[model samples]
Target: MDMRLEVVLLPVADVDRAKQFYAQRMGFRLDVDKPVKDDYRVVHLTPPGSGCSIAFGVGVTTAEPGSVQGLQLVVTDIERARDQLIEGGVDVSEIFHDATGLFHHAGEVDRVPGLAAGRASYGSFASFADPDGNGWLLQEITERLPGR
Candidate 1:
């Protein structure tokens, strides 16, 4: 059976503010914003080239705002992506790479300054957080690994 991930529900204190951040600052396309019931609302947004979208609104989720962490957005060029986000008023972290040749170490332990030598795929990363402190990581992956 084939299973495709679709939407992710993000918890936020205010719907309009979160909508503005995603739609304007993050440049995610606004897909839906509607009141579902007396106290229920649904808002959906999709990133520029993403198949999976994010949703946030009243009565959508019980998770606490800013509780979500370590969400990742993969890009072909880490520098360019980080620059765009910064230009869009996001406070992004300086480019860094992990010392380990494999996946990055959690938190900030193995982080090294600057991009990996020769812009290595999956080697470089930058991070930022939304107004409510929803953490996001920008991972550079130019090529997919075999069988991926």
Candidate 2:
């Protein structure tokens, strides 16, 4: 038996706006956009090279918009990823790393300005948010940890 995370449900006040942000600004692949009923619709999107996708639309979730946070996307090059997002017209934060040389802290604790010492893998990060304020973090991982 295997459990894989294939999709994440996002809550947005305006479905079309969220769709445009994720599909056009974020450059995610639009996989599905179907109206299930008069008040229900489904929109699924996947990142460029990711198996997991995100879904949002009418009647998809009851959570408040901008409530989802700490969503992470891994990249091999943090600077390139941040540049790409900025080029796409997204407001991305400057690259930073944890002062403790481990994972980042919640909110903005232990956040140091610029990349980690020696540009270590899994240590560099940049952050951004969608139109609805759903936070996204870009982590640079030149090499994965054991069994990742």
Best by lDDT: 2
Cα lDDT of model 2 by residue, 1-148, tens digit? 9999999999998999999989899899999999989799999999999999999999889999999999999999889989989999999999999989998988778899999899999999899989999989999999888999
Q: How many backbone clashes does candidate 2 have?
A: 0
Model 1 lDDT per residue over 1-148, tens place: 9898888888889899999999999899999999989689999999889999999999999999998878889999888999999888889999998887556677778888899878888888888888888888899999988986
After TM-score superposition, the amount by which residue 127's alpha carbon in candidate 1 deviates from its true location, in angstroms, is: 0.4
> CA lDDT of 108 in candidate 2?
79
Q: What TM-score, over all chains together, does every model reach?
A: 0.94, 0.97
What lDDT, from 0 to 1, does candidate 2 have? 0.93
Give candidate 1's error at residue 131 in angstroms: 0.9
**Residue 113 local lDDT, model 1:** 87
Best by TM-score: 2
